[model samples]
Target: MSVQNRTPSWPGEQLCNSCFYTAMRTHGVCPRCGHDGVLPGRANRTDPKPVCLTCASIPEDYRCRTCAAEGQIYRGGRCARCALRDDLTALIVDGAADPATMSTIVEILCGVERPESILTWKRSPKVRSLLSSLSSGEIPLSHDGLDAVSQRTQEVSHLRSLFEHHGLLPHRDEYLARFESWLTAKLDTIAQPAIRAPVEQFATWHHLRRLRGNSTPGHASERSMLSAKQQVTASDRDDQIPHLAARHPPSHRS
Candidate 1:
């Protein structure tokens, strides 16, 4: 039997997105297809339309912010903050940074008021050992680890004060230029393989934004630098060693 498609005449009933069937039942999977129901489209309806947690709007294209995977949009882009936090934790576990340092970084990023205490705690010898491991390439980097770097550096007391004084507004052009130059230097010194992916991802996201006209020339330049850095690093690898021209012919290789 064909299902009847009818418009509801009741005061509070509304139609579903998939099917035109109207009902007063506000909750539960659809009776016909067992799929989730769309929110009722009514002015007085109290139920809010499902929205992403981070951006607070229904995601047009659902994609996880962390893993960049599909089918994980229910929790607002895969819990961006949690994913970031976990990544940082992994970096700490791998000895990228001392636990104290990591804690200080987290406190700053999470907007903790007592950042001084955490910073002091991170200055211990035990914490210094972990940081040494990170410096010596004994431990790998992670996405969260890179985020911690960004957050910690951005939160320098003086810089934070300056930002607050400037109304906490984003100086996109200025920041873009500085970030580009800074990252170029970092790529030369950074040896951790695990952190590279996230750093590149961060750069790409900025590049896309700049391309879309949401950013400025400085931003574009910064992205260009980052892209170039990634290419240079890849070319320098033994597996994909770059071709070098010889001044003399092959016969000279006696």
Candidate 2:
């Protein structure tokens, strides 16, 4: 397939001029899948080098290489054996089954599959479990634990309506741009060092939450920390996301 998401993106404005190109050119080498794994000279995740295409596309690769590769089929790094181990660990974290028994289960899963893609992820234990779960209703899409959450159709319609109500662009692309512009304006209000919080929000949240002994929050827990020690209305959150991010700026650990 063509390079679906191999193009690079801006990690932050701090990368002025040549520094931007340099990071991409240098960091393109993916340590996991290694030289054969990355799309050399392609950019994504602000790294100009050959990179693990998926994480960078999920925009997920920006974290520590090890963590980002966890449970994932590293598109452009590592070998089959290590990727299997990573997927096994990820499945355990996602709670596919008990970690003690997962290796055997994954072995079974892998044994039944025939290779169908160059990436070899079609035979991944993680993929097998996810597919089997979906087929058998062992885990519904809405159920908890490591599911790939997607925006529902209603949610999309709601966003479109909101865009219309705001007299903003109604097209998805235009609406997205408008929303990003608004978010950028909000982030710009923050003082130095954390203005890029919007771009790095997921990684930042996970890092901070892990510090509080909360490693992985479910979708609900993630979207909002529902049961706050003190009640803060939605309005309060709207006003505070940027300011709060500034005081305790999160880092790009990878």
Q: What lDDT tens digits, residue by residue, belong to model 1 across residues 154-226? A: 3332333333334433434544444555555665575755444334443444343443355552244555545
For model 1, how big is the CA root-mean-square deviation? Answer: 18.8
CA lDDT, every model vs. true structure:
0.40, 0.38
lDDT of 2 by residue, 21-110 (tens): 344334344654564333323444555445554534435343324334222223344323344545544644355434434444445433
Instruction: Provide the lowest-lDDT 10-residue window in model 2.
Output: 227-236
> Which candidate's lDDT is highest?
1
My TM-score estimates for the predictions, one after another, are: 0.21, 0.19
Q: TM-score: which candidate is best?
A: 1
TM-score of predicted model 2? 0.19
lDDT of 2 at 51: 52
